[model samples]
Target: MKETEHSNSSILKEIAELLNEETEIVAMLKGALVKFLNGTNFETGWIFFIDAKGRSELVVHENLPEALAHKDCHYLKKGGCWCVSRYRNEELKKASNIIECQRIESAIAADVGDHAGITHHATVPLQSGQERFGVLNVASKDTVRFSEDELALLESVAFQMGSAIKRILLTKQEQEMALVKERNRLARDLHDSVNQLLFSVTLTARAGIEMTEEDTVKEMFKEIQHLTQDALTEMRALIWQLRPKGLENGLLEAIKVYAEMLGLQLHVTVSGVLQFPSRIEETLFRIAQEALNNVRRHAGVAEAALYITVTATDILLVIRDEGRGFVMDKNTKLLSIGLQSIKDRAKAVGGTADWVSEIGKGTELLIRLPY
Candidate 1:
């Protein structure tokens, strides 16, 4: 008994170490599951997260018997079993052996074969404080029942796992809130201080140009005015990127305004509704601005068109311009078009960005993002 207790303590310590090291939610969950399976008598297991809306998402899974893993675990994928039902109804409050495993029973009825000596398994509800999140299921080859001591050890591990999950999620929310606060604060400071100073300089330079009598002095004033005006435009673009004031007016209008600011004309077409999730809206808006900047800088054209197709599951955006496109090489096209940055941004949002370009036919970039 003492040896068993010592082993459980070491496993718990190792799990705590792993949980502390992972900052991302999925990585943290995977680490917990791996540690749990590696240290316990259980040979196969999986974790599922039940959202506030009661939707179940399988987060991690480990080695299973061939029967249970058949057809990509078809029985596990769909839920109408006692475990899930008990979890949803708040009845699965403790770790205990689950009898009449419907999923395994179904597999057996179908003659999937190879139960590997397993007739029953254990189920535990994963929760933190008043917040209930998910369920953890574990089994071993041919194990008809799990001992009480083993169930207690599993519950202890699960309790820690649930607490760590809560910590990670709360940390992420706080960090996001702090980032937004800092961004807005910086944007306001820049607009009130540097942006205003540039506008004043531009006005003073214009006055100097009109008042000067000598041609040389007039030319100097003209240059000063032009440079200050250019500074103002760049400053505004930087501010917009930081806070995106135009985004409140919607993505299409925001792009139109930004393109005009860059001295380019924009044409837009849409095939679906305008509403989109907040993150998706921001991602696509930023990508659109980046594409338009590339158009004005390299395309040598004043006009661009955006074609948008919004569907039930995803959105597609195509930004195109008929200008002097560059050769599709590392030196000429990829670097000049800022392809890497666009691709990275899209990938972060679970999407893809690709471009089609030729020396004379201009370029078209397509971005597809799933909801």
Candidate 2:
């Protein structure tokens, strides 16, 4: 009785930790997995998150074996297992021990590395009411099956995790919605006020140039008109950044329009389908916009090239400029500011960005995103 009470106390404490709203979804899952692995008989565990696109992502894990953690958890991140298959089919309704870990068996078959004596695991489908999220798998060294009590505990934890995940996902959706609305509002405000004001200033400066008879005064007014026209174009660029109007047509078309706005001619090449998921299209467009801005502002050139290729699982974008390029060093701040955002955005979507350049040899940016 006393041992049961002690175990119950531990479970309650861990459940409370998992229920805390302070941490984001990834951190919470990592922390909770650690607690469970340390507090129980399990030696390793991992959590997978199924996105809206039905893609399985290995979000968090604790004490993963060297074999599974190899190459940044490449094994766990890919391949299908019995647990995942059952979960996808909505057949894994409770915590149950798998006959044998399919991934572990495959690894052993391929002689990847040591399995750390982990051969079997218990699979629990993470679900809140009717909405299923993913799978929670836990294993002990040489363990063949989970006991009744262990399965019960796993079920309870999975329930808590599923609830927490639901809350976090909903919160994210709401935050993104609010951000879109706020961006649109700011874009509209700038277009209606500052944008219009700059256009008026350009017209007034032009009138000044026409009315003046003295050459010196006329030159001054002409300079004013030129500066005001630049300012108007700058304002339009800002508005476009805040709320991209060209994306409605398509990403490639949007890039062409933006390049035109900046007085740039693009040499375009395409290798695949033009359609993409909305989120991916938006991110790619933003990255392209930034790259083109760098070419316009600092490349010392009037034309650039864009290459796009798409596949079922990945998309590659290459932007090149034949302008005077800067040395690849920390001191290349002329284009670094915008280029940094291009890299960061790619990483945000599980992608990579590579830059190739040399002084006076032109610049090339290559970005690859998992579609």
lDDT of 2 by residue, 265-290 (tens): 99999999977778789899999889
| Pairs in clash, predicted candidate 1 | 116-142, 117-142, 118-142
| Model 1 lowest lDDT segment of ten | 328-337
TM-score of each: 0.74, 0.88
Model 2 lDDT-worst window of ten: 328-337
lDDT of 1 by residue, 1-371 (tens): 89988999999999989988888867887788788889888888888787554657677778777777778887677656677778887888999788868877877677786767666679898889988889888888878789999899889888988888889889988997898889899999999999999999999998998898999999999899899988888888878888887788888889889988988889999999989878789899889988988898789999999999998777999999999986765655435436777888899977999889899999999999976
Q: Residue 179 lDDT in model 1?
A: 89
- State each model's CA lDDT, in order: 0.85, 0.85
